[model samples]
Target: MTRGGREKDRDDPERKCIATGESQPKAGLIRFCLGPDDQVVPDILGRLPGRGIYVSADRAQIDKAAKKGLFARAARQPVKVPDGLSDLVERLVTQRVIDLISMARKAGDAVMGYEKVKDWLTKGSAATLIQASDGSERGKTKLHPPEGNGGFIGVLTAGELGLAFGRERAIHAALAAGGLRTRVVEEAAKLAGLRGHLPTRAGGHDGGVTAMKDT
Candidate 1:
């Protein structure tokens, strides 16, 4: 499994992380490229032109790469790493995930609100259950995710989820199976790894990951 708890896809292109030296799917890693000024630039969309440098999605790993000069070593030249590189990656990745979720909502492949999500879950139309990480544990426990990999996502906060749904706040949402659903899961796994929302083997409403309780 990747550090994001995602099963490795044999068909997906693989890259070796500079920090851990582990080869994994590119989707589970953050891509970087050298800017015109020889500065290391994050390629969140992975469309940047240049030789790509990869690191696992984990924040600690990114930090290690930045502080330990691993990026320069990988580039085979001195490169300027931005301060707070890991935080920048986290913010960009968070927005990427939010954007994907918004697209899914616009495509009518997603639904929000407790009742709607519950209905989808009951009908077996929901491929993934999304709950705010900071939502009330008791309230979140009222629903359960569908069975399968990528069936639950709890790394996003209520306000962040609200942004995706064009609301002020949201605690529950469901996604139907589709291309967008797969992308959401993949990007969300990256965000999860960055935010330290590691998946546990068991327990909690968010599939196998532990949910954060808001008091």
Candidate 2:
């Protein structure tokens, strides 16, 4: 059986953001580790070999950490913050989310196109609904997210979603409940933060959708 809605794993551990000074689950933060030359490198996959310093996923927080030398402070040594680090993290996170969705598709846990997605949603086989941020608003609004929080993703462009589904372009898709689906939600949220605004089920911080819920 599928798990309930939401992405964060209770046992996954947590970290503190150097810029915000806020402690939260690791899913909502970005990890950075020092390179051989003591340069700060974003461990987008959290696999680098060094003690990790974390910052919130928001672009502003990352910029603050860079501009204020917070990463150096967190690392307790001088470190080089790469130029356009925010853009780097955003690109990595976007790729990560896309990769997760691709894996889900290969696993038969994801499907694209309006009818397939609608079928999956109505049948409760879909735990999450995904629509392209560039899709027609009228078309996107015809489908609601599955019945749960964290069940909607509307940040990716049609071209990006197409890459995951092996199509030229795709406007809508759905993810079946599983760890991959959850990972997609978690990473996509981080990507959304860095994007400053994204499209959710009912819309996103770019405009509407208060608290990330459809209400």
Winning candidate number (TM-score): 1
For model 1 the TM-score comes to: 0.91
lDDT of 1 at 199: 41
For 7-58, candidate 2 gives per-residue lDDT tens digits of 5566758788899887778878899999999888889888889899999888
- RMSD values for the candidates in order, in angstroms, are 3.9, 5.5
C-alpha lDDT score of every prediction, in listed order: 0.85, 0.81
lDDT of predicted model 2: 0.81
Model 2, position 203: C-alpha lDDT score: 43
Q: How many backbone clashes does candidate 1 have?
A: 0
Task: Single out the weakest 10-residue window by summed lDDT for candidate 1.
Answer: 200-209
